[model samples]
Target chain A: MKYLPLIWAGIWRKRSRAILMLLQIASAFVLFGVLQGLDTGVSQTIAKQHGDRLYVSSSVAMGDPLPIGLLARIQSVPGIEYVTPRADFDGSYQKLDQFVPVVAGDVDSFFKVYEELKTSPAAIRALRNDRSGAIVGILTMRKYGWRIGDHIVLTSGLPTSNGSHDWGFDIVGTYDTPDQPTSATALITNFTYLNESRLTGRDHADMFVTKIDSAADADRIGLAIDNAFANSSNETHTQSEAELAAAQLQQLGDLDFIVHGIIGAVFFAVLFATGALMMQSLRERVPELAVLKTVGFTDRRVMALILAESVTFCLVAAGIGLALSTLLLPLARQQIGFSRVPDIVFAEGAACAVVLAFVSGWIPASRGSRLQVVDALAGR
Target chain B: MSFLDQTFALTATALRSMSGRRGAALVTVIGVTTVVGVLISLLALSNGARALGGSEASPDEAVVLGSGAASSQQSVLTRDEALAVRNAPGIKRAPDGTLYLSATTMVSVDAIRSNGKRGSVALVGFTPAIRLFAPGVKLIAGRMYRPGVHELIVSDPLRKMYRGLELGDHITLRGTEWTVVGIAAGNGTVNDSILRADADTVMSAFGRNTYQQVIVELTSPAAFDTFKSWALSNPALPVQVKTEAADFDDTFGQLHRLLDFVAYFIGGVMASGAICGALNSLYASVDARRRELATLRAIGFGGGPIIASVLIEGMLLALPGAFLGAAAAWLLFNGHVLSTEGLIFTLTVTPGLLVVSVSWALAMGLIGASLPALRAARVPVAVALRAT
Candidate 1:
């Protein structure tokens, strides 16, 4: 504890070299913080998702349309709270760049199944009464400067029974999910309106979302639901929200391999740089280290001091980098749809910094401790 | 000495004494190698994506889509509209006088990957003239799928990637069984990840009466404007017309742009860190020669020569790292196949990428050596000489 000043002095003995090394290590940590933060943040969000919600889709493929007739059968499964049919279509409003995803479903049961989406009861009633009325997500509503009672026409890929590509909807209300703003980008409308109008895939839904009664019975209930449709034409595979999200992410192809590869390359270069710098500085301070040994500092104490310097240097640099990433995460929040960098990233970064310091400083610290006073004083 | 001569002399001296500071110099070499290796490898990935879109695109072909459709997948053209586009002016005619026009639509079919994971692949329905429109697409195995038959020809890359795509394998979609009749090579373009079948057969099986898009080969690249104007001016056809180049760009631009952004962002951060390492190493190199530099300054050597010499040494140090890194990246990742959003591309380490790696390495060397060079040039001759 009393030797902190000595270690600090050793680090700053050449201020320019120290500062440059700090910046180098700090930039590596910046990448570490951002990438690791993104990875952990996504996994944590998936883990914290409502385990009681299950998505039932075609067992054959992900996007294959499932029959809405199966909705009744799924609802009759044991431990089911609420079931709603969902079908999403792509639409563009006014400009091709302004993309709006429309989710066609029963709003009454849909909102009940997805309780996180907050909306006024009056708005839900209005959406139910008006067949052609639509409830826009708060984010999408704000993007196009939409208001209630405004008639907006969207061009969809799917053609209607009347052979028109454009579909008009009266804006009934806006819904938002505070915890996840990106989820608030969907425009919700009645499935019956869509089903009766669209030319293809009528009476079919993309999936059936259900809320289960208990988290522990989710797998059992999902199995029961799948069992009923086991031999049917449109066989269903039910998955909890977490499992579904994980599978979808997995389809993006092994992000762990990429993140690990990049971080490995970064640490490899930094490790060499740190080791070289420590050795270079230690060589220049040999005479001084010998003088310290003569002044009654133990050989072990000298080793500890060198190790202490590297640890403090790496930890401080990593801390700054992690802090920088934390500040920059909000800018990525909109793009990646994550709330923030997870706190676990900082802990992980600190742990990595300690290992980095220990490995890089090992040889230099050992050489300093094993130095003979007679050879060191003689400038050998 | 002349400034040029002085610079040469100073560089020679620094290079000669580099062995004394082997550890520091190694740091710079390793740092630059890592930076350039990472940069080149990622750039190669984006290059592969560009190749995916650019390989089969030609300026002498045009795409017609339903008006206001954001993408071909969304566009819907009726039989009349498709016929009208076939008779449009400026379309190329084969020797048999048949127009080189094809109308196509696609249905998304999920295929099990070789690893037992689900991957969505497109099953495209093409008109008979598709062979004329895309002559670059040719059979690699078995025979071409006959029109009016429920047969599929899967792209070679897709056959290797997904199961149930081999020749003679039957794939059932929505209760209809379709046989795979052939394997085709799509010239490393977007078509490499799709299955092809007859337009009429696919439409009937999928209950679709409309074609999504119509593509026509123009007589010449200059004829594109004429074809576009004719398609847009006619009231009978509510369609959008774009040259094949523009269509490809619009289809694959987002993926390429994202890949480029990620490559450069990661490359930039890594380069900055590597430059810092170079700077520290160069500083140590100069510090090791403080007494010698002071003696040279005392003998009337100009500051410019010292700066130029340090910069030269830095670049020289970084050059080998560049080649080594590029070689590593090429050996490890070049020709590696990756699929994104159902499109397959090979990682290409082209000669142009070598130029990119070398330039980045030299820049790191120059920027890293600047401050250290100044410190060396402005060394206090009397003080340095007296202290050391």
Candidate 2:
């Protein structure tokens, strides 16, 4: 620790070069912080599952609707507590650019199943009393600047009974889930209104969410529900909400592969660039290193000093980069209209920075340690 | 000395000096290569995806959608509307004298991927005359599906992705089984993500009473405006008309823009780091050569030659790096197929992308060399010589 001043002096010997190296390392880490945050956010979203809730959909494909009649059969299962069916309205406000997914279900049962969504008592009462009333997530409200009691007309992709594709509903409530802020993008309306209004596919839902009494009963209930519809025209596939999320992620594409590929390329480049710069800096300082050895500094101490110099450069720069990314991510998320992007994971980034420092500093540090005083002094 | 003579002398000196510091020069080259390579590869990915979406529709074809519907998935037209569109003036007739129109029904169905996960795949039902409308499509294996039969022709790429899609294999849709009759290739277009079947069979199976959209080939590209005006003004059929290219742009334009933004943003961040690394290396090189350069200046060599030599050396180092990085991207990612939201695109490392990458590397060399070269030019000959 006493050699801190010496290490600092060595780094500052060429102030411009040191600053340049700092900027290089900092920029790389900024990229790292932002990319890693996005990668982890996606994986975590897919991994997060409500233990007691099960998602039941058709075995055929995601777009295929399940018969609403299955709601009663699923509720009949022993472990099932409450069940709610949601049909995807796939509506957009005004234009395609303003797409806001609206799920239709019985308002009361929907709220009972998704207890995480926090809302006012009056809002809940409004949704139940008015057939055309809708509830939106806080993020969605913020996105479009919507207010309570405002009527928002959405154009449905699917045709309705009146041969018109426009559907209007009063925004009666705005809900938020403190634990899962990403859920703030959801907009829910009464399925009874949808069923009565849509011309075709009236008695069906895109999926059903069931609440189970016990977490341990998830497997058995899932199996029983699937078995009951095994031979039916529309076969059902039931899985825990986590498994469903994972499956949906798979449908979205192989995000893990793409993310890893880009990150790998980036780290490889940074490692080589930093290592080269360190090698050049140390090679130039060999004579000085030898002089320190002649003045009673041990070989190990010289190595330690060089290593400390490189590590300081990397870590300090990385710290700045991470801070910058953390500050920028929320604004980026809001602009992009993606609510699920988690904040930067600091521990993972710090660990990566440490590893980067060690790797980039290793060869140069060893070279500095192995220098012979007489040979280095003679400029050989 | 003349300009050509001066440049040649500087180039010779730069080459000789760089050989002595090969390791440092190599590092700078590698850094520049990494930046350019990553930028090109990511741009290629976006280009490939955009090409897949944009090339599906031709300028000669017009699509009729319900007003305000952005995509066929959102558009619906009854049989009467389809008939009216088919008979609209300026629509070309097929070789068999029938109107060159294909009324398609688009539906999304659950299918099992080869990896054992289920995902949505677009199931499109088109008449046999679709072969005339999309002439670029050809059977890669087996024969085409027979009209009115519960038969399907799967795209070659889609077959590779999904299970039970091989020729003669059975896939159940809406409780009825359809046999895969052929594997078709759409020359890297969006059709490669769809399963083609007869319109009546698909509609009956999925319980749809209307066609999603009608695609018609105009008599000439100029005929589109006339055909569109007639369709919109016709009292019987109220529909919207757009060129196939315009429809595709509306559908996938946002996704393309997002991909491009991400690629450029990340690339810009990495490039800044690489540029700094290049600058540091060049500055150090010039500092190491200060005494030698000052000696040349003492003998009447001009500052212009010294500056030009450093700049030329920077460009030389970056050139090889650009090539190496571009070669690596091509070797690793070219033709690499990836799927997103059921759409498949193959990363294409084209000659055009390689040119773009090399240009970026050249720009890096210019900027990286400028400050160091200026510093070298300003070095006082007496002080530089006396220091060592």
Candidate 3:
């Protein structure tokens, strides 16, 4: 085609500009990649906890713990198979920077209720036999460099002073979760180890995790549990596990809006900048455009050439940005931890980049093609 | 040959040339403006957040978390413990001999956002000393709430984030509805997001009979060692004493860091697109000006002046964009309330932010124009003259 030389010459003439365009595209892709990665991480965390389970706690909020005595009352209710009570022990290792999750639960009931935690038989037996035994998530163990038999002393941030200052516990086993956010950060200890110990208060349990016999009656079962404790001193709030997690995220407040706004603003900046550049480039080639027009080139051909160039530039930049983003994501994860950034990501937003480029390119390309051949020739 | 004459000549040439290539110049300005606008807006947010997150409390003011409590809200102290803390040494006395002590508790609430979206909001119960510690809290809408009444005074940010937060609107806290009687403004601090109510009302509603943390204004900052030693050594009551500013940092440091990372990360990505736009436009400008540049060179318009002219043209385009972006940001976000967890803050676009944004536009222009300017200057006069 006659346009092939024009394309080659156009690109060859502005080598630096072309190279910069590619770099920019690559960088944008990287940014898009990271944002998608973070979104994926959040979604994954939420997805990990989704199951046929329901949570029962104080109606006020998730932080408000329900009484331990409500477990048996729930077990007796119809469509409820088993009830496992877990106490939230808010303590940390040495410093506040290091997270130490001490979840107190009856080992047998917890194991029966949730089969996600995979541990050794001997370790489970040892945990059951010992009074102050604990099973740490595999990721937690790896983070702290703790062995199976290591005796860890966790300092309490929650008030509890019964001659046991720094609570000592023997690590019995390292367990893994089904989908891996289980070890994102948290250490699970036995309920008896906490309940029998003087650490727990009279009426405090982080919440109760219950398994219903019928999946269909989850909402009904939640309502029934709430109804049971409706008039009590501490009213109960019950919802499916998904709802509970969603409610907790809702507590994060306007994060989605903030994120959406930021994304919109960033995209606006990208479009404005890129559109301006493409428009200027098309306009500057007025003489070349006029020559093409005089040689029987249609306005459509002129538009296509400019649009193609714009798309080529954006696609090059996007590809480079994405390549860099993928390479750097692993390093970022290692530095920040999996809790902050996940391993997997989605590239669905690339569609957004393509659309942005097309629209931006079209605007200037149209303006350039619409220029009169006579006026364009006069510029020379 | 005079410096001013040369500068004037340069300006004339730059303006005339830019006018000739008005279409290209406009594009360059648009691109640079966007880059500058976004960069400046983020900086403003970062500045606003930092200013608010910092402890405006007096240097002598100290807070006490429970023996094991890492967070200020998680610490629980009993009535007896509060009394003991009041009697402790190093507590500054008022003219009336009252100890400058305030006990507070914080609870995060699930709230509805302005867009009818659900969000987290924190509620705080504070004694009268909360006013003493934070003087920036000014009642803008209604009167300061009565001490014993179950009335609440919300910050402006909260008022913006949550719907139905106007005066006389009832908001439920700890399962009990409290009437909003006033709207207060904190100096853009973290407290701007809280719903402030009577201490007893919060305590009773949450069944937290025990106080979360005891804050006491010390006699002097120098007495911190003595005060800390005495408070920690107290066998009767175990508590940890830390500066108000340090405590604020501890509470929201990770959050601020996370936000900063997000801003920079997004900005960096967007900047890449902007940079590409700049390069393309500048390269085209240089190519189109070959004849004009050759004439200028023939007339002793040195390569330096020509390059400077091009850079000035780029900056001219970019600086306007910075202001435009700032104007847009101000119109969109200024005075707008946004919530996170239980805290709220208004998105502020200050004058300083505008300056930063404009400067960033200038930077984008300069960077974008440099390569093209260099290439234009490097063009052989004879070759350029024959370009047409």
- The candidate that wins on DockQ is 2
Residue A157 shift from truth in candidate 3, angstroms: 1.4
Model 3 residue B183 CA deviation (Å) reads 4.8
State the lDDT of candidate 2 residue by residue for B253-340, as single tens digits. Answer: 7667877888888878888887888898889788888887788788877888888878887888889878998898898888777777
Clashing pairs in 2: A60-B110, A61-B110
Q: Which ten residues in a row have the lowest lDDT in candidate 3 chain A?
A: A335-344
Writing each residue's lDDT as its tens digit, candidate 1 over B1-388 gives: 8999999999999999999888888999999998888888888888888887766578798999886678777787887789988778899999999898999988777788888877778889999887886555688888888888899999988998898889999987766789999999756677887899999998887666788899999999999999999988997677889988888887788778988887888889888999999998998889889999999998999999999999999999998889989998999899887775667887889999899989999999999999999999998999999994
iRMSD (Å) of candidate 3? Answer: 3.3
Model 3, B15: alpha-carbon shift in Å? 1.8
lDDT of each: 0.87, 0.81, 0.71
Q: Which runs of model 2 end up more than 4 angstroms from their true locations?
A: A142-145, A334-344, B54-56, B234-238
Candidate 3 structure lDDT: 0.71
User: Which segments of model 1 are wrong by more than 4 Å?
Assistant: A215-233
Q: After superposing the true interface residues, what Cα RMSD does each candidate give?
A: 2.2, 2.0, 3.3
Using Cα atoms with residue i matched to residue i, what is each candidate's TM-score against the true structure?
A: 0.95, 0.95, 0.87
Q: After aligning candidate 3 to the native by TM-score, how far in Å is the CA of B157 from where it should be? A: 4.3
